[model samples]
Target: MGLSLRTSRFRGAVYFGSKNLLPRNLETMKTRKFLGISLSLIIINLAAIMERADENLLPAVYKEVSEAFSAGPSDLGYLTFVRNFVQGLASPVAGILAINYDRPTVLAIGTLCWALSTAAVGASKYFLQVAFWRAVNGFGLAIVIPALQSFIADSYKDGVRGAGFGFLNLVGTVGGIGGGAIATVMAGNDFWGVPGWRCAFIMMATLSCLIGFLVFQFVVDPRRISTDHDTGKISNREKLIDKSNTSSVTVWSESLAAMKSVMKVQTFQFIVLQGLVGSIPWTAIVFFTFWFELIGFDHNGAATLVSLFAAGCALGSFLGGVIADRLSQIYPHSGRIMCAQFSSFMGIPFSLFLLRVIPQNVSSYYIFAVTLFIMGLTISWCATATNGPMFAEVVPANHRTMIYAFDRAFEVSFSSFAAPVVGILSEKIYGYDPKSVDPLLGSTREAFALSRGLLAMMVVPFGLCSLFYTPLYWTFKQDRENARTASIKETEML
Candidate 1:
């Protein structure tokens, strides 16, 4: 949830957005204190979940949206493209804002944007308006998400970072699971005679507004704590200000420097590449509801399966972090990469093969649910947990948000284009001439073709991602040690 929220697509609002963290031994933190902090975190997480629910709800109401606007595959592609492209570019900008300004205030603005845009989306009548509001929603997320991730990273030590992040991701997945259920329930039910899809966005808008008020009024950003001021009232500056002795530097210049510093790392380069390659398939998983429908599941059934898959992803994310932490502690240098490599390799069969080749003579719909659950579990192992925290280990604390921003920007840039590409392929290359008709509920063959083609292309990324691990084995150990040394010096200076 902290970072993997965006990477997972549907749930990308923001987590506990922060500045610099006051770190303690999170593992051994007192039980009462932990519970108190957890309560705050839950409230903050609710805002993000509310903000992101509309995007997650899209799949369940896609047909309704499509019909309402007379949308083609390309039009749907445009909607995804607008939001994701803006999100990618906006991530680094959000990081820069977090570094220079107040995080909670920034998050407030973002939350307001999401809430307003969601309401606007519900009120919108045209496809262009829908796309516009969605893009606005994404921009809001870009601001909130980077801040949240940076804060979450700051709260914990490197040793337990994976587990902490895993917990965050698990919570996010739970939110997404809930979103799917909400979408299923709301898609057809009329509220005040309004369409279900519109109702979903309106509800999200209302929720985001309520949550935003709570966040603005009560959310205490950890990064604002400072040692120099009386009662620590003076705001904490970016770590780079102290490190580079450039307190006078402009926020833009500092952001550029941070971006350059993060990009200069060899190990980080490979890590980003691995994420980039792997996310190609991951981003497309949002479309699986259509596939499940193509195979015979009703909208509710498909949404149920999608939720099941999300649950698997949540459980897997937790287990992946626990395993990654254990392995890294035991084996050191190559352990995390090894686990990732295995996960990616194992993921290929379950994710791609199962998605591509439908099971023959399936006894029941439960088979589909069960298979998707297993697929979700295996496919999600490398999605977060180990790698995100690994970024903290290898990079300077000051530059962490920038690195996250860069990864978000880069991955979203590529993934934003995927929607259009898949749409084009479905229409031009392998399109089914007649839209498939479901006896229970009618479906477009074009949509089915789009799903099929997307599934086929997804197989390639899983294979390519497996090979990215080899380069990391050589560079990771040295980089981790150097980062440790740097962290020690930085701590001493503080």
Candidate 2:
């Protein structure tokens, strides 16, 4: 007899047969897709958006902030560094919590932390206060991101995992674009005597709190309702609940075990190795708005250019994932690595073209716009297309959160240095003077100097990132098969 799972729209009531079993392929089974796209997927996507928006909020208003605090690029860069470094260190907490609790709870807690921090940053009177809150914001993101990634991993099987992550990132980038654009435009005006940038953070915080509540109340953890893919059995559903109810000692112990298990995976090592170098370029790109402003673009003009680039990245990430998904089916061992290398390699030419080849002048607006859009399109594929889905396949289902968390910990911690490096390079080496920069009129000489620093950060890292993906060609297949064998063994044990 076919197993029947009946439920309301959101709160799933999964009914198993007399054997208390489900088909091995949950993707083909009907018990999946309980809430459709409305609740689970959409809410997760919204959560992704909320996180990205919070991330982009501070950097988006860098000019306003610089003037307000009389801070320079290096100081602003330190704020970002503090946030990312703290977030990276705290990321493993997500995995620990996920082991003991449902992902929804973990997400809710994360949202609460970030929402408070974002609001606090807006209210702070001193730069140090803002820096502290930004660090708190990073901690909150550290928790939310891994849960979100692992949730998608469990929701989609190996075959279409790339597309699933891509869709997640695609939606997330919208928030990044929107957050950055809105903040940039708003910084030019004041709302009810409050700075527009401050208002933006307050509004985002309120919305994030609401989204977190909705997620906690409505969205069901896919793990709670579905069987593990390879085993056709519930891996840790009951155990998760029991552990949550048990003492805290058990939770930490499980967390440590998961971390150890995740660290041993060779595929994960290679991916993290590449990500350490790969992420620096992205970190450095946070200066794009500041550079554009210095290059004579007004608020709307800068927002427009950045949004086009972000839109390109959003679409490119989805397309790359789709292409990788197709290629992986044909060449399971090496397709993702090849796609990743191609995507990372594209960054070199594009970075050189945007920062050096094109003249940094108001006359080149259309040219800059087109080039940025395409550069984003080509270079934004690595994470969604390869790293995420690849990480999912190398580890067991329960270890997903830990692997993602650790990856963020390693990659983000290393990449966080890029912001400060870029800032120092521009000011110390390239002769960028924050005091001389005119946010309104723009400064051509300072802009040129900043571009030189940006070029330095972007090109070499892109080259190294592409080279780092090579080792994955050998390790992926072996690791994937081992994971499969481990899953089968897990099924037998259960």
Candidate 3:
């Protein structure tokens, strides 16, 4: 059982039990490393960063976008609404593709879609054109995200899956911060006779295309490489498929079966239910930078505040996963659920403090910074600490992509409404006058109104999200046991 010196250099192939089958050219380079992490993981993580950067590009420059399009809060909200609605509705494409193709190929296709769309959004001459491109952007994300999630699920074992997802999120958040910061700083200036925001999008698209290429060429599919530990041989189930031999009808039927299997899990159902409510607050927070700008903070200041909060969330994601991993070891059945509820409950108090208690003025910048940072650190744990790892536990390995896809489909489709709702409440109920907004000075009254709209969407949802996790404590144990039993039968049959 001991690995020899030759095995160490090709650790990836050895770990997956495919060392002898590796291509002759790649024998000495079976696994590559960067800063102690696997090259495959690094590539995928970089892809995640680019995806997030592309997503945050528009939101960071909402003020400039509004000015360029002669739009209001409602129009801005509608842009986010359209993107998320399409992303949610189209998420199943990822699951379907995963059934018939390698995830790296699926990911490459998605990256191309989004890259093209991002460039189109930058070049668009009309608001409608931008909207169309944004929809395309959403479709791209719908394809990429689920594939990425399932890839990580297969790469990490059950015990460390939370940390895997958290590490991904943490790295992805860096791209988001960079995208938002660059867009915000550049919105006031132009590059080569083009608007700075447009330039930002174009640059991101170029970078994305390169990353997509790297992913397609370098990242191996973990599921395809797995072997039977007891026999020290290939598992019949993990053989690489002959793509030409598979039919469309067969793929569809298999996909449908996976969907049904995932849908039957009570744990998945509860998690999706919580996600529907929990996602609303995040959807509404797209207006955070815009609100800060309206409160008279300049571009740099607004970006700084948002970045601080994002940095906290980034670190907190990793911390939460580590904590939940340790807790799950101790309390197996209920520890993750407890962590999730506590995280969700923290959202309510923080939403109040950030949107209501903090004075809506530039002078209170430090107060808002500290509060937002701490709030983000505490409230960002639910997904990494519980939902993702729990989803993996309660479903068969093959159904992982389907479960995550459906979760996004349900949660985002419903939560997509929050953006427009916030805009409506701000304009209709709180009396925000978009035309009266001074581009340079900013309107305190408008900031206050936007803050009110945010509160309406955030507080009640946080409480409900917390309450929804209660059922998972009861359902998770049974579902997890069933999954394990099924997996054992599957292995025996293979």
Candidate 4:
């Protein structure tokens, strides 16, 4: 017999089976739907993983790129900044798109943007060409964060969402490490008719495009709702429905109103503020490989060290998710905020260790590697597991994407300036203008200067995040309950 379709508006139920679903039949159908959801998770994440690797790929390979483009450290820094600036600028656009259209469509577009632009960068002979392509690449990278994050937030409730997000971060961060290794190994070798680095970009771009196609064809969006005001419970595994009333609202006014309302939340504002500071350290990661090359290590060695940092980042992020998830189970009210505060406070020492500790020679590489790893771990807990859920819990699924979008935009727009600033600091420490580093290039002095500048910038964010996170403990509970109530009412209105 064919499966039947049943839906109820008032009761809020949808069934795609016969009037009576036999226990065995229901079990099999449930199994099949679960499999579909699993496949969707796999494909979307695979596309995301490749996108992350592509983002990491350029920075990892930037050493050779610098040589090829005849660019100085600051010029290379500007390239990184340019891409992120574009990403920041495009974040709102991506959020708006996500809100207006379906997630998969937006994701597909972003995937193609990076793949094509990265390919263009691979083929470019001019610095401007490379810069232009990198900017496009940043636009692609922008949606990967907010879209996927919104999906996670939309799909799961607060109690279980951390683990889902943590896993997402784990895989993505590992992809970052893998991207570095791939770029490093391929930077100098020849491939099927292309230079090694070029081959790296082309191959990744090709694979991502294929994943993009799969996203358009197969990825199923989970349920997005204004929320049920009465029940305060929504199932992650529930089949999605477009609540008709909400769907009929004028998109522009409603979306703007939703955006304005979330921005007014004090906790949301604090989280966005913390994001500006937290994102600065990532600039170090982007520049870390370049610094390694300048310090006398070859390309492969530097990549390996950076990978170590990535691994630490992945491990820490995974642990954060696990810890926070556990906390949610044990302490429903303040677990997430508490974990976030702890992570923020813990970052201070790690930042100091990685930046303040001097590397005298190549033998001292492991010291920096270990410190960087610990630093990576310390840095991830807040963003990966805590932040997404924290913002998401207070917003309805309808506006969840923008919450993340604005947060990203807030942070990226400010953090975009970090590269030039860090470069300037490095210049002062090295005691040379951009053009005159031949003798001191890659010297211990340059490394120290770079590290000191990086360290100097990290102090404020790490210290201040704890301060910002503290207010959440006092405010998050009430805010969350209020949102929960409001989302339901909003859904009914829609």
**Which one wins on TM-score?**
2
Model 1 scores what on Cα lDDT? Answer: 0.71
Per model, how many backbone clashes are there? Answer: 7, 0, 0, 3
Which candidate do you rate higher for TM-score, 1 or 3? 3
What's each prediction's TM-score?
0.85, 0.92, 0.92, 0.87
Question: Quick one: best lDDT, which candidate?
Answer: 2
lDDT to native, each model: 0.71, 0.89, 0.88, 0.75
lDDT of 2: 0.89
Q: Model 4: per-residue lDDT, tens digit, 1-494?
A: 12232225323342433434556675665676677678778887787688778879878877677667877667777888898888888787766667667788889989988889988988999999999998988888787668888887766667777877887878887777787798888886888777798888888889889989999898876652323332356532222223323554555665677679778877788888777887776765587887776677877778888888888878888788878988878887778877887887877887776666555467878787878778778667887567888888777666787888888888987887777677777876655343433422456666667666677667777788777777777777787888889877855554
List RMSD in Å for every model shown.
12.1, 6.5, 6.3, 6.4
Quote the lDDT for 61 in model 2: 90
Q: Model 1, range 292-391, lDDT digits (tens) per residue?
A: 6555566677788889988888888778887888888888787778778877876667755565555522244677678778877766767455568777
Expressed as tens digits, the lDDT of each residue in 257-285 for candidate 3 is: 88999999999999999999999999998
Runs in model 4 deviating more than 4 A are: 1-21, 192-194, 224-249, 432-441, 490-494
- Angstrom error at residue 132, model 3: 0.8
The runs of at least 3 residues in candidate 3 whose Cα sits more than 4 Å from the true structure, single-residue gaps closed, are 1-37, 229-240
